[model samples]
Target chain A: MEKMLAEKPVNVNEEGYLLEFAQWDKDIANAIAVEEKVELRDDHWKAIEWIQSEFKKDSPLSIRGIKNSGALNIKEFYELFPGGPLKKASKIAGIPKPKSCI
Target chain B: MKNLIILGAGTSGTMMANHLVSKLPKQEWNITIVDQYKTHYYQPGFLFLPFDIYKEQDVKKEGKKFIPKGVNYIQKKIEKILPKENKVQLENETIPYDLLIVATGSKIAPQETEGMNGPNWHKNIFDFYTYEGSLALRNKLRDWKGGKLVIHITEMPIKCPVAPLEFAFLADTYFRKKGMRDKVDITYVTPLSGAFTKPKATAALHYLLEEKGIKEVIDFNIDRVDYENNKIIDYADTEVEYDLLVTTPTNMGDDLIKRSEMGDQLNFIPTNKATLQSLENENIFVIGDASNIPASKAGSVAHFEAEILTENIQNYIKGKELKEEFDGHANCFIETGNGKALLIDFNYEQEPVQGSFPFAAIGPLSLLKESKLNHMGKLAFRWIYWNMLIKGIPIPFVTAKMTKKGKQITI
Candidate 1:
């Protein structure tokens, strides 16, 4: 699906997660963060940057991964993104939702 | 003769030994498998063990019974793998290998969580991922007056991902059979978003949670278990109290991976998802829960990978291009209790769907939907696991790759 983010057309999934990392930018992330009702503060960007880098490296993201990441503690991670932090953070960072083999 | 050393004589290693013993020329290649333990456990039975559906004796046997006559089986601890040198360091001696297969599978590390392994360990808090834990939980469940029965998963990538859910379903059945269904308030907690992660599976199976009266606590990334308070505190500070906590703790690969400096943060080896070969070395192959592949760490996945790894090993020995043939296929029976089970056949690409299995329209077992025949298949799997699966015998009508013929993929 195509959606307007940051006043530019971008590819996103049904849940509004950006499909292409190349299409992601700070403005688009800010735009998605607003949609998720999360205000992008400095700490939030720290997590977003760390998670985006991990995503680029193809590391499976999880709360445990975040705890070991040194970017933020899990409590701060929850505080920054609130409910389902990984899902919202990945969306804001423009990565696919972390999945388990089901 | 060249040497082939397989670590961890569990499901994958034993299957590899059986498969390669016939395939590799005796004069050319010598095979040896090592594990410190003598007993080869039927691990899937651990799920049923707590409910008294299976006795302790039913799930274990001598490990030597499964290895073929031609292969050499060693009962000794493996210290580390010197992969660059193409050698393995055992407890007392160093052994060299032309090829190495690491099947040193994952296990529960309850110590990873704060207060998990503290005073409440195995008393109120329990894990059913091991023989000892299962037996302890069985004894606990036998006499316990139930209150809040929590079946929790601390993290993902746990072996047999559905076992906790199965535990909850069987608990419902068990309590009902014991005439104590009304007393036990069962809760299924997970770090995942829901009971089932895939689309079709969630759609088909979500009702079971409500139907069985099992409450769900989703997106629960547990920070610590406050044993004194009798509640699990998540990162968000959300607390779920329980009287009896059956948790699948942080499942990590063998510490030998850490000692060898060959694994990721979780100690699972990085491997080619399709080929099952270690990304770092061509000669080292990883299978089962040891590899950090995106496949579920289940015996069924190992069984499928063993088939592909056998072919790849043969290819590598002949100095040919490796076959990227493993499709992350897994076939599992999900016991839904009440004399019914759900048989799901899926791969890295496909989510389990509703349809007949093995046959296009005519199945002895149905997929996704519950059936008595599927339950029978679940019971019969124990015999198959011992007699055929570990012995490298191809199961009748079941292939290594996931078949899309009978499945209703679209709907």
Candidate 2:
């Protein structure tokens, strides 16, 4: 129910995960993060940036990827974004919801 | 022709029906499966229903669809099992069997816990084990703002032991997505001192709880549900309050088992864990959640037990020694939320260890480690459950027995 700054209508799935990757921006990420109760600390930005870049390169983003990406380890990634680190981080980073999430 | 009657056309019953029809000569054996309900629910899917990960259609199918053509599928309420006479009494009929398979799986009994069925039930208190309970909890969660979301287990030996933890993890993700993570206070209350029964897995899962910021209330043996006050009081007088209580109530075997006086205190048939043969009666074999085995009451355990039981049943019919022995083998995927899950495979003797599964050092799925591939594997299981498992078709790599080939014993 939170508003995003997208000029075109931003479409999301039933769970509020963005359906379109092109509609994502830092503003949208901030808005989503705020709704998620995340303050977007440096470590959080590092993970978000890594996932976004991985998406652009067409590489699969995973827990192992985040661990090996040197951006964050498994423990830190979970601390930065508790519960669902990869799914939540990916959503904020503007990627399609991963198929494995369900 | 001799009759081999199986009670409850659920997971084990359906699988036994499919497995036996092919092995037992139709000229000499008549296979019949009886249950009270016409629909068979994929019980594992109930864990996802509360999170909206699985819909009703995904988990439900006609019970008769999976039963083979040669077998007789009866839909009737079982009155009692006269094991001494080798007969099962239905409401209107008394069916005789040369051999009987007690697959009348367990059920969640909220009434066993005082005050659990009070006014708050289905309003503020809910369970996700049954179809109706899951559906009700799903609707309640959709518009639920934020409050104390407590996940409690009334006791152990419940079906799918890891489901409560999975529910808590999913709830955390659900609330985070709804932008109310901060508004919600999540707590996990269990009878065990840690997240799981196994120590190694507990250490790993305990870290997951801390990482998620979910508080743990361990060693809380629930004595009663103070429903009006929205509190659960343990035997030690310890109380935990909650706005929404999602609990796994006390699980027990079917009421018929209790009436027959053929089961343990919990109504679970006392069976030889290795042989699957009833300790009380030789003609009766207990499988799945019906047996009082130390193993987890899970579908995978049932599948494994069925393999051994099928062979034992054949041996019994042939007047040969029952040679097959079941080793409490069970494997399950623990959904950790955020598109990742963990896999654990073990048996009665061995606990889950950190290693690759099915292949050594080159696993597409990692054991005791969270990965997206495991999550994908878990999701794909829904398809397998419908198509292959119930049909008695063997999965490519996994077998009935637990293997240490790919597992790391040193931990």
Candidate 3:
């Protein structure tokens, strides 16, 4: 069933981290997915929260619509975290990067 | 031996009254202030009213609350200014003054624009400049589930140029929280081709607008408001249908200025931008929104003018040359929602440049850059405006002259 679900490939290469830690990832991802909110995996959560708190020079929530100003870019993030999407890792870490960005 | 009479008890007048009443010896010169309304509104507070951030009572208080004991307040409508005689005609009596200071501020004259005051004036169309309109729109927004909510500017030369953009940002946050972010579609319309008056500011603001998914209708000349058809028609006949329309109407000077043929066609008092003295007559002086000074007519500009005009008046009385020291200085706090804001400081000779404020190379507030510290300053100003600014207590190092101390280098 996991293989069949993985074959669909609905999200992207950027979200591959969920596949690596599929065993424990289900708990946090479920909470985020159920609320229709963006979920950050444990490691990814650290980056997003850090960027919002320290890296962001503008306002606190100013990272909302800004581009490339995020904790990690999708392309670089995907290359660095080949085993799993940082978002999945970020969520496990309790970080939330809004999926609202274009 | 001569008395000083100030017109309009708005922000500029209130400040001048406080400034002069404190400095001028009580028996030496009598100060009289005139206005039709007795309510003194925290004008900046009006921007937060519709969002429930500021309530009706929070922004409004009696005019006398801020006025000092020695200063006399007259609640009466001004009929006309006979500058040749140096007197102002009120409803039942005439006021003669040795020196007249015009601080009559501007107002939202939706009636002057075609089709603006039609059947749909406040029903489908609304303005947040007045207390009544803000409260009315707040109610409409509360029950509003979502549709095409368009924030528009009818024309240029509007007060608080950055406000409409802030309103759009807040509305986006408001809708998303109600679980209706997907249900609402927001659009921002402006008369300028850019999102803001200054180009650099526009580029920064434009990026935010795009990020928030707010559509931009640039260079739109609002020809008329078709209330029955539920659309705003542009000069070229382009139209945007809206379930709800919020706008900043064309601001005009006092009615007396228009009636007496002493102001521009839009009712703005004609004046020397450099000296802050009225052009209609030599003895009359204008400040704040009343003066037709092609600049952003904000409260900070008035504060800058107050510093110069108070001295200029003394110079005039001392039989000295009227100094040409007035340069339009306006600084504002732009709220970007989510507990952060932007602080911009600019003047007539210079557009807004990114730099630190109050000190050279060391500032708690950075210009052009956004920070949570700026947001705190924006929030703390309300207390300062009421207790410090209006009472004429000087803010350290924030003198009228624009210093380049904390300003960034232009390499």
Please write out the lDDT profile of model 1 over residues B68-178, one tens digit for every residue.
988888899999999999999999999999999999999999999999999999999999999999999999999999899998998877899899999999999999999
Candidate 3, residue B274: the lDDT equals 75
Q: How close is candidate 1 to the true structure, as a TM-score?
A: 0.96
Measured against the true structure, the TM-scores of the candidates, in listed sequence, are: 0.96, 0.80, 0.78
Model 2 ranges off by over 4 Å = A1-102
Q: Each predicted complex: what DockQ?
A: 0.49, 0.01, 0.01
lDDT of each: 0.91, 0.84, 0.71
* Interface RMSD list for the candidates: 1.9, 17.5, 18.8
Per-residue lDDT tens digits for candidate 2, residues A2-100, read: 334444457765457776788787778887888788888788888888888876644444443554577777667767876556667877887754431
Quality class of the docking in candidate 2, CAPRI style: incorrect
Off by over 4 Å in 3: A1-102, B409-411
Clash totals in order: 0, 0, 23
Candidate 2: lDDT of B104? 95
lDDT of 2 at B268: 82
Compared with the true structure, what per-residue lDDT tens digits does model 3 show for residues B348-380? 656677788877678778886678898899889
Stretches > 4 Å off in candidate 1: A1-28, A56-58
1 against 3, candidate with superior lDDT:
1
Query: What tens-digit string does per-residue lDDT give for candidate 1 at A4-84?
Result: 999999998656877789999999999999999999999999999999887765567788898888888877888898899
- As a whole number from 0 to 100, the lDDT of residue B186 in candidate 3 is 91
